[model samples]
Target chain A: MEKGILETLVGVLARPTSTIRSICQQRPIGWAIIVYLVASLVSTIVWIETGFYDLEGMGLPDVGMPTIIVGSIIFNIVILVVFTALSHLAASLLGGKGGYGGLFSSFGFASLPGIFVAPLAVVGMLPMVGALLSGLGNFGVLIWSLALYILAVRENYLVSTGRAILILLLPTVVLLVLSGLLVGLLLLSV
Target chain B: MSRSKIIALIIGVVIVVSLIVLFFGQEIVPPHPRVAIITLTGPIQGSDGGLPFPDTAITPELVRGLLEQAEGDRSIKAVVLRIDSPGGMIAASQEIGDMIKEFEKPIVVSMGDQVTSGGYYISAHADMIIAQAGTITGSIGVIFTHLNVDGLLEKLGIEMETVTGGEHKDMFVTPLTPERRYLIQRITDAAHDQFIHTVAEGRDLPISEVRELATGELFIGRQALELGLVDRLGGRQVAINVAAELAGIQEWVVIELAPPVPSLFDLFLGGGSILREMAIARLLGDEITLLRTLLKTYSLPRY
Candidate 1:
């Protein structure tokens, strides 16, 4: 039997390998969307409370709080879709046999780590040790989320851990090489 | 449940509890006695539905809201009104000026780059006014501009026909007659007298002395100090110190009262209006924009 949403969420952190495999087999797109929505809502709330979206201090027109909240939620959802598509494409090029729905579901579940942002933001509000603790906590959460993402790719694509990491890094490597070549050509022309 | 699952569940519960606390933990604690700073920048006008721009225009409603906030808060001992404007509507300025005079707490005005005409009209009523050495101020007069575009319309081969209930109803659209000019001049003179009286009363100067300086001539902060138009020659820090001194507070914090956050509906509607204005301005070219501004400016009596 397929596990429920709550069980699957806890399972992702507790037993990632099996949970991710179950997620691939189930392909619960609706639940995946709900997960992304919750993560985005949490992110928006933290940003608003912490005044992270206020641009007036930088001498720019303030895109008001409502705009920031709505814009961030939409942007985050778009990023999830775009990131999944790119990762799936890269995995396909690397002789992987994962389907799109399985990869998307796993990637969506990976966003569970972002829920810790709320607690970390509260720590960030402390007077002296707040900044350091918040920074380290956020870094840890980011690494945790990245690990989940790698595992998602590995389990869904039926690939080794090394191949999954390589697939994820493929886009970045190509962009860097393209940028380097462009700079060299500009210098030669000059 | 397994050990790892139990740990994850505990962590999840802790996160939810923290989120609830963060959202609902706002309890107003009595703060240290502080001097609240309310900044008034840009042209003074009526409220524009509370749009969040970089440099928000000064409005009587905005000032009143901030003043009410300061008055209600027991911790706020005094207020520093930091003003940066080239003046605006006469009625709006008078409304703010009246509020300043009636405020129970000590209030100080800190002049910025150019606080002239209606700007000075409002600042004159503060308990004390401080300005930088080169701050432009003291344009204590009223002005009314009448634009006659009939000749321009004729040149463009466009004649305007008007139906009016009164003779002067169409006076603005046509060339000003001698009688209309005298009538307009009298109104301006009355407003000018009112400006002079306000400055004299607030500055504790004689009517004749204030009248002599009310020639619509601008004065720098040093000249204003020498002429008794301003009490002190200094910056915002000096104004804050004077406010603190007047309030008789030794140890006090400084609080800046920012505008209220805009709602979602306000964001969508106000943002649409701003975009519409920008689009019109871009499509109409610079000259049309300037003409529209001039028409808006001259449509009413101003200080």
Candidate 2:
């Protein structure tokens, strides 16, 4: 039986491997999009509350709050799409047979950990231990989310844990190498 | 509901509550009496986003926004304008000065390393001016430069033609005729007089006394204190104390009205300019860096 959205969300955290396998089989793209949207909106709200877009105090040009909110959400959505696409390509290159829809759905659900950023940001606003705790909490959330993503990739693609990690790292490594080469060429020309 | 559903509901509630609290917490809580510190650094210009660098100069719009924030906040009982500038455009300085003069609450100015010309124009209207002993200030004059590049152009064998609807339309590029010279002199003198009068009015000194001190001469903080240009010889802390004292608050929190914490976007945008500036600073030392900045910011008809 197909799981409910709430059950699947919880399962992604509670039993990521099994839950992600179910998600891949189910391909709940609409629910996945909704989850990603909520995560992005929460992240943007936390950022605003933490005073991220207040440029006036720094003597910089004031970028409108609305602009930041909309821009950041759109930017995050684009990143998710691109990341999922790149990871799908990487999985394909590694002889995985996962459909793009399944990977995208699982990847979107992986963003559920980002909602914790709101609470962590509040903890960060504390007087003394705020920053440290917030930083550690955010780091923890990132790690947890990465683990979920790895599980999602592995289950969807029928890959080993090591191969899943490699698939995830492939996009970043390629991007960095390309950037470095471009910089090197520019420097040489200069 | 199942156990997972209950857990999810709890998590959902926690996130909703956090968002609501973060958004509305400040309004819900009673704020403490605070003294807001608004910094006026670098040359005071009309607006930000000047070439080479954008954030180096102080702008009237920035000052107005900060002042308005302090004015609107009931918790903020007083404001301290921490000014560190060599001064820039005349109109920008005057606009900021008018804001200071019109502010309902007590305002104090704390002078930094260099507060001269247009800087002093804005500070002159503050309820009190505090400066360190070594602070360089009091360049109380207006300057309008007419660059007659006709000579340079002639030397370069590049003759230029000009069409004028008015007699003084081409006065800037051409050599200043006696009539044009007199008109320009009158304008500068009027601006200088206005500066003297503002200083006298704000400091409660006689016009003659202020005039004597407003000879376009730079004075150290001690000399300014003696000359009645500055009220006291102290630093930012003293200014803050004075502001709090003036506001009749024995115990108060000092809130710096600063920019919001920069986001990743801001860092990405500002990183190039910051790195370029650092490189320049390293290559040419601090003084040259400052000179370069001043050159970039410099405009005509300034105090």
Candidate 3:
């Protein structure tokens, strides 16, 4: 009983379970990352082609719907396939179970917390209170990331803290670099 | 702590600070001359459906009241127009802009989280305008929005009632007549010209320079400063300090404008979102001034 109590205490001390459901329950994180990325790409294409971003600028290209759709699909497909493969490799290394679904689930879950950015940025602009809240808001994101790490620990597929940290860092750098390269290529091609 | 209790603690601290400032903080400083804090909130004009969303506009009446207060009061060393709006209708925007120009006193505009088109219009001529570095501003442009309510009306088989010498007299109602589009364009151009003109004059930028910003784009405070839209980049406390310094007041009081009434959330759930609470009370019974909000929103596509 005492041992059970101690283990329970440790679990609680480890921080509350993410309550985000089982890691693989929703869209597999790996595929979800691809989906999220693809959606983002599509949204950007729509924004540009629809002249959404150009609303502020006096003039912008008269890019048609066909170009926008084709561009978005092509970009997203490339992104999805690439990230899917990488996530698979990561999963294999971590001794993760299953194929596409498991890898996708982990990838998807890792980035879920970023959705809070929209609301956080919006709310952060308030005056005296806003100044105070936005200062605190960045911490919530950090906590969310830590919570994901905990979730990973909770599942049998645990990493050495250093390996886990590296896993997080490498993928983020990969995405950023990819996005930057794509943006540059798009701009240059245009 | 449980989330509720943690939230409660935060509330308690904010309230304590606010109260202490309200009641006793002024005694320590030397007598700083008084700065007028004209209460400006809610829809700008008469409250008969005058906004895209009352729950989200800085009303005409509020602007009018502020102007009136400034004109009437003499003890007011200077006026600090604290604006917290995400922009609103062209009419309201213009009216408020006119009021600011008419005001005789030295005024300083202090933008909160969001002081966009209409809000910026009201404070453009202040001796200075201060905004937080992350504060969303600019959106120095104009637009007209029309929702396709014709389908809903058709579904309900709601027939229109009209008696007009001109066919397009009710130019704004939707299923927007082709003639109405022309009229709207004229209106948009006029408002746009005025917006560009005011920003140009206020920021001392060339008309062409201002036109660059007139793309109806939104900006962070830093960007706004770079664009010459805002005079300073800081939040309310900085605005307050600047106002005090400008007014030559050594020991003065700083009071926030109270909401006209409690927000729906405040009425029921209570706590959280002082902004939303203020928004709910002031904006209820207002129309959705969608042109500015839509324009501003579309302008900020992140890619």
Fraction of true contacts retained by every candidate, in order, equals 0.20, 0.49, 0.00
Residue-pair clashes per candidate: 0, 4, 32
Task: Report per-prediction Cα RMSD to one decimal.
Answer: 7.9, 5.8, 20.0
Worst 10 residues of 1 chain B by lDDT: B264-273
**Which ranges in model 3 have alpha carbons more than 4 Å from their true place?**
A1-190, B1-32, B38-57, B161-163, B177-179, B256-303
Off by over 4 Å in 1: A1-96, A124-151, A158-190, B1-6, B9-13, B28-40, B45-81, B95-108, B125-128, B197-213, B226-231, B239-290
Candidate with maximal TM-score: 2
Best candidate, DockQ = 2
Residue runs of model 2 more than 4 Å from their true location after superposition = A1-3, A14-18, A53-76, A95-97, A124-136, A158-166, A173-190, B31-38, B47-49, B65-79, B103-107, B240-299
TM-score of chain A of each: 0.87, 0.90, 0.45
lDDT of 2 by residue, B121-223 (tens): 9999899999999999999998887654455456556677889998778655567789988988988899899999988998899999899988899999999
Q: Candidate 2: TM-score?
A: 0.78
lDDT of 3 by residue, B1-303 (tens): 555455435543553453343233335322335566654543333332322233344656656655664565444567778777766666667667777777776677877777777777767877788888888887777766565555555655567786778767656554667777787777778778888888778667899988877887888989888777888887667777787788777766554433234334433334323444345545642323333333343321110
Q: Estimate each model's TM-score.
A: 0.66, 0.78, 0.44
Native contact fraction of candidate 3?
0.00
Q: For residues A25-130, could you state the per-residue lDDT of candidate 1 as single tens digits?
A: 8899989888877877887787666656555433346787788778887898788887788888899999999898998888888888888899998776554566
Against the native chain B, what TM-score does each candidate's chain B reach? 0.83, 0.78, 0.67
Query: What is the lDDT for B275 in model 2?
Result: 43
Please report, as a residue range, the 10-residue window in candidate 3 chain B with the lowest summed lDDT. Answer: B294-303
